[model samples]
Target chain A: MSSRRAPRVHGLMTRGYADDLRLFGSGKAKLGLLALVLAYLMLPFFLTSDFWLSVLDYAGIAAIGALGLNLLTGYTGQVSLGHAFFIGLGAYAAAQLGGPDALNLPLPLWLLGAAVFGALVGALIGPFALRLRGNYLAIVTLGLIFLGEHLFRNLKDVTGGNSGTNVDTTATLGGLDFKDLALLGENFSFNQGYFWLIWGLVGLVALLVKNLVRTRPGRALQAVRDRDVAAEVVGVQLGRYKVGAFAVSSGLAALAGALLGSYQQFVSPDEFSLFLSIQYIAIIIVGGVGTVFGSIVGALVLGGLPGLIDKYSASIPGVSTGSGDSGFISVFSLNQAIFGLLIVLFLVFEPRGLAAVWLRVKAYFKAWPFSY
Target chain B: MSEFLQLCFNGTALGARYALVALGFVIIYRATGVINFAQGGLLALGAYLAYALNDTAALPFALAVIGAVIASGLIGAATERVVLRRMVGQPVFAVVMVTIGMLFILEQTITSIWGFEALNLGDPWGVQIVRAGDVVLAQRDLWTVGIAGAVLAAFFAFFRFSKLGVAMRATAFDQEAALAQGISARRVFAVSWGISGALACLAGVTLAAGPAALSPGIGAVALIAFPAMIVGGLDSPVGAVLGGLIIGITQALTTGYQEDLFGWAGANFAAVMPYVVMVLILLVRPYGLFGTREVRRI
Candidate 1:
């Protein structure tokens, strides 16, 4: 009976397209997901440190932005160094719609408003993508960052100019303020409360993106990314899909920006630079291009790294935590150097990124003994 | 009229620097099909290297500039050999990001060594000006324009006559065919990067020699050079020079007239004028003024 059962369990062989598209293809995947969910629920309670909680929270925010970028550059094959522009747009939108001396809307409304605004702007820019290809498009998008910076700095009434504006957007939703959560008669710190809120959204966004990428539209996107001309020959409406991808990607970026602004409680023009856009690009690259899960993995690793470094700077040799310290390199320079090194090393050694490594490990175990 | 003339002179000088930088971009882009984002880092490195040679090593100004250029060229060649040579046949995005990665690393390394403080390059050209019919031009600006012109002429002649230059052009035109013709693609690539580095060094020294002190922000001039290269056409050397001049003049005029005529655009509108002009020009000519239109095959 045991020998017969061993033959019967041929291990999640796909018989059809639906099986291929299954989110959890095997019992192991389901178990892995369960473990993830359990960890998400229990980790905050176990750790209970504000510093680590905030780091995780920031990582979740980065994951959201990286997911958006992956959709654009990774999946759609559109290289944009202008993500920071849309992010800035969203931050200022939040400032106007939800901050003090403004309309003061609730959390959901402002976030949605920012997304809508970003989508509109993205739509306006999408026509250029239709005309230009490759390097031209990249450079034009780069111009958008400078143009956006100019607008942000000049629009003092809305953005509060160079000094930046305070974001008083409350995280309250249906009488449950994430800034000070009262859950099951237990009061949690702001960081603890925010971790749940941010990570929950991360899960939601991840699920949404995963579902999108698995469906017909997702196939169309990948098709366009691989070869736009061939995709067009196959009767894919090039303009609609291209514009739609832009709108969706920028909308997600804007949503992430809204979260970032509210979380930091300050929205500044300086915060949105070309470097920030590069950081998002790096995350998607390091995580795994064309894989939704890679975005979160990248964010968790790269996003949490800076904070960890800052916290342990005192212990690290040859790194000055403060100005006028006895060190050759400042913390800022060290961080920049690390980011650069990570990008170079990852592209050179493992172009497929962390997700590929994870898949390899899984494949090794799955093919145990057979070695095929 | 004199003020306008002065602005034009200043713009021309600025454009000369931009042309040098844009020309460097064209060389690398033409040969390897990779946009070297690290050019800015190279520019900074060159300027700083010159500073070290001149001030620290007590070399003559010309000797320091030559030494810096040679050192930067070697570094550029080594980068191509070590990192980018392996990236041959990779996707354009990946290659571009690699350069960007190099850029960040180079920038931070410079900052770590040099710190953030601005320092004079100690060039012979101080703040002295030469007046010509009510228009005052800095002596350094004149030298910049003169040197840029000479270099551009020499490069064009090299491309027209030299064997190695012809080989590089052949590689740029058709890599497989060039290889079939027995041209060493690796040597061409390394040589292209070296030339680009030397050009960047020249641009850096010229820009930092005048009133503008050498600082970390000197690298950012390469960002402005992007508009010049794009406006002229990415693959065209002559186009890059023309684009640089157009962008430089427009920027100068914008700075001179913004307060009086276009205050609504905000302060320092001149800073972004290159981008504005680039976008407008790109709208009309998607391939740029001199860029070859890409031919697609099914």
Candidate 2:
């Protein structure tokens, strides 16, 4: 039996050709990976309860947001600390349009309004912001977060001020009401009601991102990220791509925010703080940059960690969960500490992230006989 | 007319604080070719240390300030030796990101140590008001302006005439050449961080005595220094001061005159004004008012 396995293992290392097992360098491997991902996503519906399904829903929303950031920061090499501002803009636009006393626009138009408005605001700000580089860029964008919050707070008619705006579940896609669990099954709640919608959006965004990377515009973005001066010399319009990336990133972030707002039946300024923006960046950093699969993996790891902590908080002696505050807060602050440490650690030691580590492990198993 | 002069006076006072902070920024940028995002956090730490030392240890205010500055200088030196020194010769983006991560670490540390309360920091000099016709000026504000002026004069002399300062400037110009000439780039790096650290402490002290109480959020004022650097020129020391003055007065005038005209919220606009100016300057003159343009070879 051992001798029978040797040639198979040797074939993995020799591959008969260099490109056969080169990891993401072949279409066969890519298709195999896609099938595996489909199984992983669908497995939850069969194996998990509603609570776990809800966790996956939140992960889907985060993965969408992280995918946007990865496009801008990973593919284009631009840093932004104002991501949550765009998300807030999208969420509030939808809420205001569909609120009880809002202009009471149709649901489809309202969602479109959120994305278009976010892109416009992004373009307007990008001209000014795209000039800054390095930490200066980060600082300027961070300032925008504060400015956005202040603007929202001061504009009472639009944002409802600090008290925040709430929706009564009236906004939905056609007759598919978000709160109507009956549409799904007798056993399903609204959280489970959102399971399919969030994943469908994730799948759509992932496909869109994957296709974008293969287009000419995507090639130009990658070129600029690799070397701006060289890209400019090759007839790539640096300014256009810089602004375009921000617009796309902001529009996607808004899309996620809209989904979140509709799912929760509420949208508030506090929900879209700088912390959320940072968390999104952290998600992408842990995820493989510029890869769709990385976004999903990163979102699951970072998003699920806190939920795990909340569930197990009571089991850990001397770890006060701070019950008066949301069980989420006490655990999440610890998560922030861990996340910050992870970024530093990843940058210094394993900058390629968990995806890179997983690839290494897979390679070792495939090439077991030779171990070369 | 008097109210106008007083607005200018208050503007200059705020400008002086901005200049001190921007000077720290310029020093590090010129020497290390990296913007120290942690400067604001360092300033806040310095201010908090002074407050803590005076309140907790029951030390005299003057002695506490001295101790605080010393602590800040040590922090700066340690950061250079450990964090920044390791990052030497790395790509600009990587180094910049490290500094940002440093900012996150420092912000959390400050929050952990001080909690979130804003504290009223009293002036070293007793509070007194002087009237100039229709306007009023605080004695502490005058002190801030005077001290800032003195610090500027001293910095000029140190950089122009002193030996170590000349060596620092030489290292800033060409680090490898300076190293070839037997001037220790490491020492130059240390001295730059030390001086910058001291300036941050000075700015923190004076700012603590301003209109608002000292809080961790005061680091937001770093935005003012950022635009001032761009306006003054990144490489020019004198430009930093001039830029600070211009930015300060422009913000004051806008708040004073443009508020009613534009139906804008004055204070919020004041916060954003520097960034708006920074964007304009960056577009029109990338080298800024006093900065030297560089050739990119790719």
Quote each prediction's TM-score.
0.98, 0.86
The alpha-carbon deviation from the true structure for residue A229 of candidate 1, after best TM-score superposition, in angstroms, is 1.0
Clashes of each: 0, 0
Give all candidate RMSDs, comma-separated.
2.4, 5.0
Please, what are the lDDT tens digits per residue for candidate 1 over residues A1-372? 545544455447877899889877688778889999999987767888889888999899999989988988888888888999988888888878887679899988998998899888998898888888777788888889999999899988888889999888978888999999888888888898788888888998898889988999999999888889999999889899889888888988898888888889898888898888888888988999889999999999998888898999989998887887888788888887888888888999999899999999877887897777
Put down candidate 2 lDDT per residue, A288-368, tens digits, no spaces: 666677888899888666666678877765344765533222454455556666665566565566778778887887778
Against the true two-chain complex, what DockQ does each candidate achieve? 0.76, 0.35
Candidate 1 residues lying further than 4 Å off, grouped into runs, are: A1-11
Please report how far candidate 2 places residue B11 from its true position, in Å.
Answer: 1.7
